[model samples]
Target: MYDLGDIVEMKKAHPCGVNRWEITRMGADIKIKCTGCGHVVMMPRREFNKKLKKVLESKADQA
Candidate 1:
C-alpha cells in the first residue's frame, strides 16, 4: 500500500517522461505528484492500484 510521502512508480510513464510519483494525499481518492514536472493527479483508489507498478520508496524506509 502507498502512503503519504511515499515514492512510487507507475505502469506507464507520464507525458513528462517520468514514472516516479510521490503520494501526497490519500483517502477514498489518492493524489500523486509527478516527480518530473510537478503535475498532480487524483484518482480513485481502485484505479490507482491498477496503475501502480510498485512502491519505490516507502514511508518507513525514509525513517
Candidate 2:
C-alpha cells in the first residue's frame, strides 16, 4: 500500500518520458504528480493499483 508523499514507479512511462510519480492525494481516487514535467492526474484506486509497478520510496522513508 502507498500513502501520500510516497514516490511510485508506474509500469509504463508517461508521455513526458517519466515513470516516477509522487502521491499527492488519496482516497477513492488517487492523485499523482509527475516528477519530470510536473503533470498531474487522478485515477480511481483500482486503476492506480494496477498501474503502479512499485513504490520507489515510501512515506516512512521521508523526513
Candidate 3:
C-alpha cells in the first residue's frame, strides 16, 4: 500500500512531461506533487490507484 511521502511512477505523463509524483498526503484523498512542474494535486484513492504505475520510493526507502 502507498502512504505519505512515497514517490510513485504513473502510467501516463503529466502536462509538465513527468510521469513521477511524490505523495504528500494520504487517506480517503491523496495529495501528490509533480516532480517536473512541482504542481500539487488532490484526488480520491480510487483515482490515484487507477493512475499509479508503481511505487518508486517509500518512507522506508528514505530511512
Candidate 4:
C-alpha cells in the first residue's frame, strides 16, 4: 500500500526512463515525481494503484 512520501516503482518506466517515483500527493488521484529526471506526473488512484509494482519506501515507517 502507498501513502504520502512513499517511493514506488511503476510497472513501466516513464518516458524519462525512470521507473522510480516519489509520492508527493495523494487523494482521489496520486502525484509522483520522477527520481531520475525530476518530472512530475498525476494519475487517478485506481490507475496508479494498478500500475504500482513495488514500494521502495514507506512514509509511515519513518515515524
Q: lDDT values of the candidates?
A: 0.94, 0.94, 0.90, 0.92
lDDT of 4 by residue, 1-63 (tens): 778989999999988877889999998989999999999899999999899999999888998
TM-score for all models, in order of appearance: 0.95, 0.93, 0.89, 0.89
lDDT of 3 by residue, 1-63 (tens): 777888899888899898889999888999999999999999999998998999998888788
Give the Å shift of residue 39 in candidate 4.
0.5
Q: Candidate 1 vs candidate 2: which has greater TM-score? A: 1
Ranking by TM-score: 1, 2, 3, 4
Question: Candidate 2 — which residues are off by over 4 angstroms?
Answer: none
Q: What's the alpha carbon RMSD for model 2?
A: 0.9
The residue-level lDDT of candidate 1 at 20 comes to 95
- Top TM-score hit: 1
Q: What is the lDDT of residue 40 in candidate 4?
A: 89
For model 3, what is the error of residue 47's alpha carbon versus the real structure, in angstroms, after optimal superposition? 1.0
Model 3, residue 55: displacement in angstroms?
A: 0.5
lDDT of 2 at 63: 67
Better-scoring candidate (TM-score), 2 or 3: 2
Which 10 residues in a row give candidate 4 its minimum summed lDDT? 11-20
